[model samples]
Target: MKKILLAVLVLLTFIGTSCDKVDDLLTFYINQEETITIESTFPIGVVTPLSPIPVKTNSSETFKNNKTRAELVKDVSLNKLTLTIADPADENFDFLRSIEIYLSNDKGEETRIAYLDEVPKGVKAIELKSTNAKLDKYIKGETYTVKTRAAIAKPITRDVAIKAAMRFKVTADPI
Candidate 1:
């Protein structure tokens, strides 16, 4: 009976020692950090051409042998007009601001008949660095001429911002 008790005590002591050693080797892992980044891109604008307008012609009256006669004719033609704006190619994204536009005549002189104080109601404004802008407008023999040009009026720019996202991962043994 003494021998049996001694054997049981030895077995219990062995198990206790093994459990303590396993606890000492166990460990835990953790991760803590953040990253930041910036990204940028330019915005583009588009414009469509306007349809042609027809003009009506009037006739002069003639009298012969106490009789008067008059005649009139209808004239139609396609008005080819195009509106163009230069791309702002200034330093890294400086064209994000504003753009100025101007109108000039065929003699290389500026014209007041065709003028734009700001972007027109239906026209879209694009952001790009450039020196000249050309546009097409209908002429009724008064407001605009056959050869008119559009140019840059003032340099415009605006501030822009961009951001990027990232993720982190971790793996470790538990204590």
Candidate 2:
């Protein structure tokens, strides 16, 4: 009985690892980068929601390059999202106590994709935690909207521009 159990466990392990390898072969990444600005006169000590910014997706081109179409896509999720202060040469995220970034489609379907709580000070760039939400439709679409809600830590005298970089992991079936 012991030998039988050990053999079964070993077989299951091999099958699990093999499945992962197959998935890896079908996986690819698509990166999207955009710049957003926080106005200098923006108020402090409030959780404010920013206006939704529309973004055109490059998924069609990326899909073609990967030899896959939107219909063949099996799953899409955010791999990573990073925020960096782009303007003012020497500025950081010190003014932002926390921030949540949302993605919405044309039909108004929305989901939280990434966020950073208790943002570190004196740093030029920070990576936000992914909500692990499935993003297939949003990425497959031609355009989507990005909205942000942030807890401001301090007042800003000048507009602070931030570059938001997002990488998405996509798995699809071969055509």
Candidate 3:
């Protein structure tokens, strides 16, 4: 009878240990949802979103620049577009994964100005929720229109948006 009791005790212990191990494994499989947040800065003398600036896009309604549906602004010096991104809800995001900036020229051509590794003259790019970068090259007084959007590598349906804060600093410069 004692031997049988010992065997039952061992079996109960084994079941308890097995259950604990399974619980741990289940906890490991659970994952938390991730998110990202990007912020921009509009300086004291900067132009702001008085209204919804229309985004120019192609025939498919994808964000692009061309004659029709082209995003535009007055000609401002390169010194005026100071901005930054900060306070990402998730720090694990690939911040530098894919980003692009475009400059519109006199001929109404869209010029690719900057990307992940590059920031245009007077433009600054930094990571953090509340950081600031200045575009000293864009003179304050000049007027310029710009189009900016973030590029996501995953799929076209994904909404990857960034605020293109353009502030034409008031200065005595010509466009």
Each prediction's Cα RMSD?
Answer: 34.7, 1.6, 23.2
Off by over 4 Å in 3: 1-76, 80-88, 91-95, 105-107, 112-114, 118-145, 149-158, 173-175
**Rank by lDDT (best first):** 2, 3, 1
Give the worst 10-residue stretch by lDDT in candidate 3: 27-36
Best by TM-score: 2
lDDT (Cα, 0-100) at 158 in candidate 2: 92
- Writing each residue's lDDT as its tens digit, candidate 2 over 107-151 gives 979999999889999999999999999999899999999888888
Question: What is the Cα root-mean-square deviation between model 3 and the actual structure?
Answer: 23.2
- For model 3 the local lDDT of residue 69 reads 19
User: Candidate 3 residues 75-96, lDDT tens each?
Assistant: 2222223234323312222323
| Per-model TM-score versus the true fold | 0.17, 0.92, 0.29
lDDT of each model, Cα atoms only? Answer: 0.26, 0.91, 0.32
lDDT of 1: 0.26
- Candidate with the larger TM-score of 1 and 2: 2
Candidate 1 lDDT, 1-175, residue by residue in tens: 9999999999999999977565433311111111111112223432211121222211121111112112111111221212332232222322222222223334454332222324333222322222222222211122222221222222335322211111111111231
